[model samples]
Target: MDDFDMLGAPQGSAGNGIGADEDPAAAFLAQQESEIAGIENDEGFSILDSGEVPSSLIQDPDDANSRKQEVEWKEKAKLELEEWHTRQNEQLEKTKVNNRAAEEAMVSELDENSPGTEWERVARLCDFNPKSSKQAKDVSRMRSVLISLKQAPLVR
Candidate 1:
């Protein structure tokens, strides 16, 4: 008996009688042509898909406009950064000027009220021009407090 597959088909021969050694491309082409020749008059088929081109497939090999735009955007970004730096420097200079003025005022104030001169400044701050009877009484009380403090001896 001839050799046969489990399905009773002859061994080394496909069900179509094509041998394994036969060129698959030629066999496939012959099968397709036979199928097409066997076709009777019938309605054609139509297909529909989402129709969107995938990003990977939608590539331009030479897109100079995009590169030009990128270069322009970079230049504008750099200019904006430079302007920000200039503004920051101006703000820093203004702050430094303000700080220097404040320090000078504080130094002059300290110099004017330093050591023995502090008592004169304190006396001027305490002096009051009394107009009413109540004001005069308050001033009198202040003078007594000052005199008592002045008479007190300093402990070594």
Candidate 2:
């Protein structure tokens, strides 16, 4: 009937209260026992003694189906994202090819070492209309700079 024994304390020296009614160990055991008794009387309290679970605790069938559908939707969305990325990469590659072809065409049309004056060659390569007032000024400035560079003496 000792409170310490109810708490599974060792039956020997320690189990016996040190001759005091106000022992802390005894008080703790009394509290635990009262709580356990209260829970046992509750109608909703239960112990799953058997290995099998009761149907009440099982998940609803609709929830399981919804989860399965959600997983499938996520998988479909992931595949769509991957396909979009692949298409974007293909378009980027096509653009690069087109740019390279355009550059090659321009270079073939006019070689940098072709026989012409420096101004003529530069103006033609840049597609500059020397007739335009703004372009004429730019071309004149470029011609002067080029002429000065060409006439400058080699410093050795």
Best by TM-score: 2
lDDT of 1 by residue, 1-156 (tens): 555436675457668977867888998999998888767433233222565665544676557788999999999999999999999999999999999999998778767844445444555556544554653445667765664554552344
Clashing pairs in 1: none
Top lDDT hit: 2
Estimate, for each residue in 1-156, the C-alpha lDDT of model 2 and write its tens digit: 775466665455454655444678888999999999998899553536685556666657788899999999999999999999999999999999999999998887666565334555444445334566753445767756655544552344
Tell me the lDDT of model 1 at 27: 82
**What would the TM-score be for candidate 1 when compared with the true structure?**
0.36
lDDT of each: 0.69, 0.70
Total residue pair clashes for candidate 2: 0
TM-score to native of every candidate shown: 0.36, 0.38
